[model samples]
Target: MVISRRGLLQAGIGWLPWRAMPRLTMQLDWHLNAQFAGLCVAESLGYYRRAGLVVNLKAAEPAMDVVQTVVAQPQTLGCAEESLILTAQSEGIDIVAIAAMLQASPLALMSLPQQSLTHPRQLIGKRIGVHSDGRKAVELVLYSHNIDPQQLDLVDIPYDKKYQRLSQGEFDAVQCYALDEPIEFAQRSGQVPTVLPLKDYGFDAYSQVIFAPTSLVMDQPQNIQHFLSATFAGWRWAIEHPSTTANLLVEQYVEPDYQNIAYQQASLEILADYVLPKDAPRLGIIDARRWHESAKQLQQAGLIAALPPMAMSVNDNLWP
Candidate 1:
């Protein structure tokens, strides 16, 4: 049975059929959108079912702490940025990243033509509206360009309302998803915005990471393996068929005005670049070097006290 809020709170693993197969729940870091195309495709195409598993896919809510939820709930999984996993790990949260979904982070700093902030250094003396969760990323970007964080004006904007404020001139720039806000703004305003992608600015990190309680990894290795294989296979299919997957995302998952189809397609195409970059070893392979670099960037930015043990932060063997 599909697990909703009420169902998840009440249902127990004992509620499953008396088979030994494991029942699991997956929590996404954000709301349903093209970003979750792979998981949605996996669900719609019966990949999860074929693996002899029952899964509950939970969409994100405001102020929802996904990692903490995984820690609090048993037999559950979560997807979030590796930076968050690292930070939580440093704070003594026992979690291990199993697979890297997006090869590069889509987090970006966006501004319209009037702002004319062409370079990262130009951010100084300007107000940048950012989500509190994204402060570390924005910090890394500023420091990478030798710009001191104190030199810029940072106003915390609710993640949901950033675009509205940026459009109304409340912010000279805002942190947002490259695939999402830029396209949405262009579609609405007919003017392309300047997008400074964090990855290009040396804030590279894997995004939409699949992570689980270390207990879950050790206790249910086979279940995790099956889930990864099927999930990555679903991603492969989604990447190969962006338009088809986008249609499924809008119709069955998050409904949008039919006119938004073009915007959806554009977002999917941009996501494909991050999900399947040139010479990527495989669709869902996590780069050990990139992870190390990500950790180093976080440490330099003072987000984490220091680098957590690599073995503790990631366990990529499960993906293969």
Candidate 2:
């Protein structure tokens, strides 16, 4: 999962150390890649430093849950999937969303060309591999298409082996992010796989959101606001200079797999669509419309028992 899982953003947020030079830890649910290029660029360009903050970029393992991490450490700002936020709320965990980087979620299903699975309805009787955390979304996608999830054969699989399983003909399709897996699969197998993005089938949710414990939002509103502004500024600059940003990412933070400047560039270019749409006024602006809609979608998916308190879940006041 790319917690940078999408949000095209990351690398910045609120909560500064009160003394002379402020410092904060930004827990990224996923590892370093182009998904967080905007954030990495902010540090690369010293945006956070100029704002009087030292942002520590921490990467997470596949099993590290950002929700619980933030809950355990209230002082840090964490990047996470929005659905997890709603799920946390259902479980009595209160986290406030300050801003979202990936406005349109990149969650998708990928299949080999031979399978030719392009639509949700095509999955009937097919064996599809699902990421452990992605089951609810898969179910919601099927429900949105007016198909019963029981009609398909769903298998739980590990993230690292999903694509390989698909290639071996063990499965027809596998859950993936629209931008991440597709490019990776193509580069690895030398073939373009068919993709079905969940947003197209009615399972749209925010992908990359900066979240903090309840007390942090209430206690440090001004610091959070300033951190968000710096983050948004970094996103703006990254969006405007995709090539330079990609290069910087490869030179600095990106891991070995994403060290390819071309690959990082491709990811950043595709993420442009998710980070900020054509008509978006600015980067990192969280809206209530998508917020409520996503909550409803989660309920329909049976991922959450009841809708979380919408008014308190997102920190809209953080924006200017």
Candidate 3:
């Protein structure tokens, strides 16, 4: 199964009662966590309110398909991996990307630093834990390294158990979101795991992107733009003040006792590398060339039959 089948994100943060406010439901690509702090902060800080909108941020479940949800409810907007956007288009899902949430892909291979599993080639005979949705990326990494994926011992592990099992030596290495899982394990355990980002090995693809049905783009262009503007502002603020954002998140949005505020700050700090790279175009702006290249990578991994046609793959004009 692809990551789309494994999990998606959403969080029903809050809703305003005003009859005139445009209420939009946002479907996230994965469960709520520090990764979605910007969205949560946007709501808490009144960024959405200032935009004349009331957004319902819905957290995704392992069984729910974001594309299906967005398709069934065209008025809704959703976030997911860039490859999913291409795949959805190939399958006739008609979704258009609004902006890239993570400018750099966060997909990574993690292992104990002592194992020396620092490079893709080192895993030829080693057992590597992978999420069902992560198979294509693992394969792409292998191919990029001139190693056949068949040479690697790939084990399909559930998302929640990948790190735990890795710590127990169940897997020599495991795939994970570079920004979140490694920090999570480091916080829980004194040991820090070594990470080999797939992007470093040429399997880069956008991790989280905000998108909506094509009809929504055409019918309510202003709403989509407003949401993006407010979202970008929220992310800028979140990155600048992770500690404060984390506190706000735990207080109202995230589970107060379940998620530690400090841990949330740590994850967001690491995420700055992806969310706001040193010299990117700007926050939430999609790079057209990278978008096309990602489609090619998807095709190379055999996840998609072919690269999506330019017309169907991206709308560069959507962001500005």
Candidate 4:
């Protein structure tokens, strides 16, 4: 059957005889792009169907709060950075991270060549545009460099239009996906930007961390297990076949600013570095140490009321 958005949303790819399988939905935290290559490949290639699941991929809308969006429908798993997930859990949300696709979050600060922003310390005296949601993460980068948050000028910028503003000289820098934005920013504006990934600093946290309601984890363990196994397998395949997965992403799940196939491939290759880093234990494996470290940092930054329990933040046993 032809897998259109109609079919994928209304039903599964090959769901006629498998109609009774567990139906699930994933609420993405941002627009669909190569960043979600694994899930895109998994859904388009019917990996979910083969694993007895009917999954719908929901692309994020502007101002969409992924945590509350999924919480409203507990059956829907959400993909977001672990920092936001930790904040939610600290505030009494019952979400548990099941798997981390990105061992290092690609969030970073980008600057024009003239600014010559070579290191985190260079950000101290300049005005950087930051979204409200990313303020904490950016602050952590500053603090890690022994620089005070107030030492730099951080003006709130719209996430969608940051590149436009940055290119227009509205600010010295903007928070962006180091892998995704620098490509398009360079292509469109014709000026290569300096991308400083947060991980290059001490702000280590997992991204694309998939989490579900803790109750859902306890209730539908098998269904969750099937989803994770197939999803990670899809990731391994995507990492190995970056070009193929990039094609799928460009064709099926492309965003307005991310239409170029070459750009998508570049983004996917950069994503592979984060997903399967040299020292990574394995793709899609959540590290207990990272979760703990992220939670503590979030607490220290006053982003969360207190550090949430490890069990509440991650389900380390569901990696199979």
Give per-residue lDDT, candidate 3, residue 94: 75
Worst 10 residues of 1 by lDDT: 1-10
lDDT per residue as tens, model 3, 146-214: 898789788877777666788889899988888778887887767888998888888777778888888
lDDT of 1 at 26: 91
Write candidate 2's Cα lDDT for 1-320 as tens digits.
00221232243444445466566788998888889877888788987776667778888877787888877874699987777787888788877777888887888899998877888999999999886557777888898888888899988887876778889999989988886779989999997999988888877777788888878878865556556766767887887898999889988998887788888888888999888898666577667677888888878767689988663433333333
Q: Give the Cα error of residue 20 in candidate 4, in Å.
A: 1.2
TM-scores, all candidates, are: 0.88, 0.89, 0.88, 0.90
Tens digits of per-residue lDDT for model 4 on 119-194?
Answer: 8988877889987567778888787777888898888777767778888888898888887888888898999998
Question: Which parts of model 1 are misplaced by more than 4 Å?
Answer: 1-21, 255-259, 311-320
Candidate numbers, best lDDT first, in rank order: 4, 2, 1, 3
Task: For residue 92, give model 1's deviation from the true position in Å.
Answer: 1.3
Error of 3 at 178 (Å): 1.5
Compared with the true structure, model 4 gives a TM-score of: 0.90
On TM-score, the leading prediction is 4
* lDDT score, candidate 4, position 164: 81
How close to the true structure is residue 105 of candidate 3, measured as C-alpha lDDT?
A: 78
Against the hidden true structure, what lDDT does model 4 obtain? 0.80
